[model samples]
Target: MCAEPGHYKPLDAPVGPEPVAMVPVVQLYARDVPGLAFPAGTDLLQILWCPLVHEDDQYAANPRLLWRSTELTAAGTAAGEPPRPHTVEEDYLPRPCTVSPTAAVEYPNGDLPEELADLLDERFDDLKEKQGYCYFEVATTQQSKVGGYPGWTQPPDWPHCAGCGTRMEHLLSVTATEPGMGRWLPLDDRDPRQGISAAPSWQAEADPAALDTFGHDMCLGDLGGMYFFVCRACPGTPYTHRYDC
Candidate 1:
């Protein structure tokens, strides 16, 4: 699909690279995250992006977000397969997988209040002794999730609303890496620390799928993550995003 399109379509791009169709990144309904607010009368949130890097736009995929009402799209009027991009960054593409939402609590990676941080440091040590698990290692989630602290690999960069000038609420995080090894590893997989005391223990033959691949496997710039934001106070629910490693 590296060739030009058969049909022509209007574009808003200036003199730049040839325009190409954007691909579906993700689609979510109100039912998926009941606590999250949706625009008035809209029950669905659809996200698509150009699967190519944009240096001007934080050197990451240029994502476009849309809010839709499911009741409005009649079954017959629903479109067929979407047009594919003629040129795409293969590393930006994600594998098709069913989303099974799970409820969880995670400690913040970067946004702990100063006073709370003092208390948390003391509590972390106590919890590690009692639970035999580092709270940061076991409780913090650095994977894709809805309505929780973003597992930032770097310092936090929260965006403010352009329309109202208030700090935007973090909607979700789309990360390149998901939970795999360490205390956060799935119970179904054999513990990397369980086998004999040997070097290269993590690679000592167990759950090939775990080591062979990564969650979604998208090249998000040194295992970074994209944080979506929204201003619920503004009309149309104006949104923005922040990306970091």
Candidate 2:
């Protein structure tokens, strides 16, 4: 399972070697090809060569024809180092990792309280079809919303936690969910009280001390793609009124 949480699992495999980081496919264009397939176990500095072949030929036109090895030629093995072998294992599926929901916490699910399970099912269908991957999208009604200051919204400096007075730096990871799960979770580590507000006034109501203070009352929606959670330690804010509306 790729790390994160609240994800859906299709099949289980004994943990193998740590997964290899793939080159981002978004950078590739249709007309272009990867300089060479960086097969498993290939070193970074190795020079790979691609072999050219004719569509059909019983025998080589020239006796001196050479077949290329997928492994990088320049990649050298130190003393007692085994030569890296090239293997083309194309069985791995590409999907975004899933973030698991907080265990044992009750979600305020209204119409379908068990919707989270259903969301996982939908994600599985998408993965089977290879449609696309899902990341955390803020729900319209999650209790606490994540926040960040403009221009520097990359966490630590941006998304601050009011409870521990700490910036959410570490990702308490979860499992990889199936594609299209649509199970965006609340960023509970950041906020567990479920009192995040989109408006400054709502925040003021949540924390009346902020009424005369300089802090801004930001909501989770402002932080693009972040799921917010409320802090239990500092339940200073009242239950947000906007959740029911």
My TM-score estimates for the predictions, one after another, are: 0.77, 0.15
Candidate 2 worst ten-residue window by lDDT: 58-67
lDDT (tens digit, per residue) of candidate 2 on 94-117:
122222232222222232235674
- How many collisions per candidate? 0, 23
In model 1, the clashing pairs are none
lDDT of 1 by residue, 1-245 (tens): 12222322223233245676777777888987887788888988887877666655466667788898888854436478867776566656776654555566666757777788787898888987986666655455776777888777787788888998998898888887654432233433444655534322222344556544534667577678888989999888888777886
**TM-score top scorer:** 1
Q: What C-alpha lDDT does candidate 2 achieve relative to the native structure?
A: 0.24
Best by lDDT: 1
RMSD of each: 6.7, 24.2
Off by over 4 Å in 1: 1-16, 74-79, 179-207, 210-215
Candidates' C-alpha lDDT: 0.67, 0.24
